[model samples]
Target: MLSNRQLLVLQVIIDEFIHTAQPIGSRAISKKDEVSFSSATIRNEMADLEEMGFIEKTHSSSGRVPSEKGYRFYVDHLLSPFRLSNTDVDIISDAFAKGMIEFEQVVQKSAKVLSDLTNYTSIILGPEVFDTKLKQLQIISLSNQTAVAILVTNTGHVEHRSFSVPANIQSSDLEKLVNILNDRLVGVPIVQLHEKLSDELTHLLHKYTSDFDAAYHYLKGALFDQQSVQLYVGGKTNILMQPEFKDVEKIRSLYSIIEQEEEMAELLRSNKDGMNIMIGHENKIDAMQDCSLITATYSLGDQQMGTIALLGPTRMEYSRVISLVNMLSKQLTNTFHSWY
Candidate 1:
């Protein structure tokens, strides 16, 4: 445990480093209005803090910087509740005021709002389709040989795919398949659609249609073939503005990890309920060792629907970003709940 003096000195050092991205010396801490100790006393405290692995001296400068251990301690013990500015609140309120109807629009707009507010890369894992029940299905004909199949989920998300209509399959046969699927499959969760279709509805389809095999094959391939998670990212280039990422190779490596949508989506899904912060080496991925990742979950009632995250250097504006993420997560939950 740290005494009052040590805690105050650590807080000032971290706060100064966050704003200036430069090493801080004892003299600077002594100059702060909140600090009443002399430079000599502050130096002794700094030395003790460094021995405890909270701060380290740079080879090029006599000043000290916070280590990953230091950042972890600061985040865990020193984070105070930060208030959001009126303008910040107004921006979030205005974004949701556009009367958007689709989940994609809401999530995409959220990504943009967060990135613009914090100047960091924002990623949102959209509502999991597997968790949502099927609301409706439609098959629209475009030509004699081709048509479009639309799947609507309970959460207001829509997905459509095109498939080939063979000469052997008559229009009446296609209509019959659609009717059978709608009757049997509505209100089924997307993840179980395939199993439900094959195990339970096969006999029903076989009873009503002459060639159930062919029509069922086409419908299954069209809708159930792809049900992966959705990921939305905004301001990917904003990381370039941070001085810590000035190394070209470092930026390239980080971008590669972000571009792997599946990996990133899985990583975000692993977070526990509510807010989580991982600093520097605390992150498991290689490229993110020098970065900080903050994540918060948005839910519908008791069920967690997705995650909202911000990625930036370890010197991030933690208080403000934490407030923004916490506020946005709650807002997303409320917005989604209102829709249902």
Candidate 2:
């Protein structure tokens, strides 16, 4: 555990390394970038910081650089909101605002902008189940024994499934139940749908009639299916050109993590409240120990949770990347809310 002063010194080293892609020395921290400290005092702080395993030296000729511990500490303690210049914000906003006909297209544009701006891979996620707000739901009777369930969310994502209903329910009764369900559930949370509907199930069936049992069971089954969950991934190939990941084996390892649905889902679900930066080894994934992940959350309407993230080597562009993502998240929130 280092003192607050020592931690600030380490954060400077890491931020400098990220910006210049060069090893940083004590003189750099002591000199004024944004802080006021003398060179000798900075050197003492650097030495103490190094002893605490936060920064390390590469060679006798080179300056001290941030260690994995240093990066983690810098992110958790010393970081603050990074402000973007007006020019940078305008360029990306104008580029993406041309025409986003579909919500998927908007997500895709975010990935491209992240890669183009920082030259790092970006991951933009759709609403998690907990973030999903039901905009509409209806059951369409295809026949006496089967019905098609259509569900829509405020984010414009749509899901449909064919359910095998109980043999006894008439088409007219199923049609009546559909109207009943829609009025009550139009703005409900997807997470609350099952229990909320279940609470009203007996009342719904009795009100619709005794013939509605089969349709009720089928509706429950449709809601529980995992197909209702959706994941969107783009810019997966953008990081391949970085010099830090030119090695074939390293590239393959990173690809494996991105390809796994569970890995991406776990990453999106994590740290919903604050901007999260997971450094080497601090993240449980062995394959990503050489990389850093910076993630932030965006809200959809009042009911959905969305995430924006950037993936780069341990030597990532911290100030600029943070600024870009923060602004982009607000843009996304504005765009999402304006739609409905």
- At residue 160, what lDDT does model 1 achieve? 81
lDDT of 2 by residue, 4-96 (tens): 677677777887888776788766676756667778888888878778888898875458888887777676677787878788888778856
Clashing pairs in 1: none
Top TM-score prediction, candidate number: 1
lDDT of 1 by residue, 1-340 (tens): 8999999999999999999999999988989999998999999999999999999999989999999999999999998999999999999999999999888899999999999999999999986877888888888888899999888988788888888887777777778878887888899888889999889988877777677777778778888887767899989999999989999999999999999999999999888878999999888899999999999999854674799999999999999999999999989999989988
lDDT, candidate 2, residue 200?
Answer: 68
Candidate 1's C-alpha runs over 4 A off are 142-145, 165-167
Flag regions of model 2 displaced more than 4 Å.
1-52, 57-65, 73-87, 95-105, 129-131, 140-148, 162-174, 201-203, 206-211, 225-230
State the TM-score for model 2: 0.74
Q: Give candidate 1's error at residue 84 in angstroms.
A: 0.8
CA lDDT of 234 in candidate 1?
A: 87
